[model samples]
Target: MTTRPPGAAAPATAPPTSGQTPEQAALRPGLKNRHLSMIAIGGVIGAGLFVGSASGIAAAGPGILLSYALVGALVVFVMRMLGEMAAANPSSGSFSAYADRALGRWAGFSIGWLYWFFWVVVLAVEATAGAKILEGWIPAVPQWGWALIVMLVLTITNLASVGSFGEFEFWFAGIKVVAITGFIVLGGLAIFGVLPGSDHAATGFDNLTSHGGFLPNGPGAILTGILLVVFSFMGSEIVTLAAGESPNARQAVAKATRSVIWRVGVFYVGSILVVVSLLPWNDPSIAKKGSYVAALDSIGIPHAGQIMNFIVLTAVLSCLNSGLYTASRMAFSLGQRGDAPRSLVRTNSRGVPQPAILASVAFGFIAVGFNYLWPDTVFQFLLNSSGAVALFVWLVICFSQLRMRGIILRENPEKLVVRMWLFPYLTWATIGMISFVLLYMLTDDSKGGGRVQVLLSVLVAALVVAISLVRERIRRNATQDALASR
Candidate 1:
């Protein structure tokens, strides 16, 4: 069952076999366009949007918009490249498979395992954050208990079926879209002095200019903002991973890629613009309370702050679910490609990869246990280890696209349903840009804490690469021995 990596032509378009299970049957050539559409919308707008932006705004002040732009543009390029390969041959592995096909087994194995590691860490982080919020509302229950409950609930939902996962994501993304759109619309009205009880004080576009004229942190700050925001958009590409299980994968990838940038731009930059405009960059609330909630309160909206908390909670759960799914599929993909244990590839009757799911969840359970036992040590370790994979993932996407574009055009030119514009020119420029960011993180004062994450993630990436090289050597020797026996 080892299919050629994407960009190779499907072998003569042979008809699919008969007597397949319902999942094997309904698993359409393209994923359900609806499922992918929501995932694309929701994935980028997850916990990062709700929680991470607070720190970015605090670091860069009113000028965080520039940070969102820089990172947003990078994501546009990454997703375009990913879309090109996913459209050619839709697979649950997404970029991991692309790396294997375009690069080599070592590349695929390293990237797949690294990505799996990324999501499992996120699962623990999100559930921990979510549990903290739950404990706020219900002091009777400890945070550990809340974390367990949240994990079990999502685990059941994910194990139900692809359709159930799709349904949950649909509503999850739906709420995010509504919240952002409302923020933009409502915040826009307030900025123009439209709200009935609007204070209309020392705000009104002055914050952008008054505080060192939007570049208060200077041009250098823009790059710092990129470091903050780069992680925010990490989950957007999960849509392609889910595409392999649905009906119209090519179409979904195409539409999702094409529309992804503009959507992210509108939501991320737009919301930041509204927030900074509504409040002073140096406002006490900016540091004590988040920029977004503080701004909403400044505009005379009584409960807007708490209302946002609920939305943030939804965003956290959405990320938790997606992280579990992403890690599971990655492990499954690694197994299928002979990189991981064979048991990980085993699918339940519902087409769920049980071993992979459990393996991914295992870390969350352990991290939760640590939270119950020694909160400080385990929490910092999780934070430190979870830091830099976003950059790594983006770098791999850029490289995979470089190799994939050439192969797709050469092997099956017609299958380029969604082509990246400017070809090798923009693609090469993107590589350089990402390289600069990684180098810059080492010295950037603005990324004081973030540097730790970047460094740790680099260590993880290196370890994965080392393991991949060793594994490949062993595999090669086994292959040679088998051939010698014949």
Candidate 2:
């Protein structure tokens, strides 16, 4: 594979020639630098961070900050490896394409389909979450109606053009960033006894140690906290896929990789710190009202719950918008490489992958139907089946980077604009850490059926891998037969 320098224009594909089909047309570089920047920033902030941190804080107490840090570090390392490869060769496939070249066709096919499955499930999950909020606000519409409306709006945005998706995500992510930043600032002032009308007794750093110390449930709780908060970091890798469409794919990817550390530290660890420091970790309100909302209420903020709901709603929409885009792009990439139906590679006059987007949203709509029709049995199974896919994707990146490093260096060392820290050693360490997290998930069942999620996710992954291997064997046999006929 040839490599381009950082900030260089992406490699161009041949324009449609006479009698050539539009299916052979290339994806347009419609995403701007600002779009890419916000995508990278907003990718780290998920709806889970807004709604999910409460359980983690309850489990790990103030030590939940440590849990965030551990997971943050893992993400930073994984992003670095991904950045190194993506910078060298920008593709919408992102890590999946790298896995194909570095690992094997089977590895890429398995992980690509698994990742796609994960995001389409996420589409249903986010649509439902957003619909609930909308329903509460306007009791006129049923929850399923709201779900259909939310999915339809974003699906239209994605179908319009990549730029439209970026525009929507830009504002959705912007709201989340501003809300989190404001929360941190106000919570910090209250913790220091500076915010007026704040409850001095409740808003102080003493909350961290006053009640059972930081690790209230012993050190073991930190691992449990890891299980709770780890998935909140899932969206951080979306930027790499988005970067592939930017004008300067290499620079866009490298910049996002470099800044991931601070993004995690400030948005995740820093915000959680403000939460734990503002109120006692064991405070029932924290668990009941969520970490951020409870923190705002302690500082005498009026309508704290409503305010947080709005922010969480924005986060949900952002995740939904990006989920559709990411899933479709992965499918598009897979199609380009012959893993998926060639129909998915066909782009419209505006350069949008129409078929791919429709295909992804079609399944998303089905999942939404299952969510309403069988919330307990069918939807629960779908959720569990895709639960551990985030870790699986990260593990694949680590392994792909291990082999891709040599390929990049041998071909063009200068293309290594974003290098992984410590090379093979750090890469291997990341692999071990992710594997450990997956294994740890097996023994823990107290939090949201951890073991069952892992087991079911493993079952799904094994089935995908089996299909990939079978397909590869058939393709190889066909090639041999064609050669024999020649």
Clash count for each candidate, listed in order shown: 8, 0
lDDT tens digits, residue span 46-143, model 1: 67776777777767877788889878888888889889888887777888888888788888998888888778777877898899899998989988
lDDT tens digits, residues 152-206, model 2?
9999999999999999999998998899899888888888888877765644678
Error of 1 at 83 (Å): 0.6
Candidate 1 residue spans exceeding 4 A from truth: 4-31, 201-204, 372-375, 444-448
Query: lDDT values of the candidates?
Result: 0.79, 0.89
lDDT score, residue 102, model 2? 96
Candidate 2: residue 124 Cα off by (Å) = 0.7
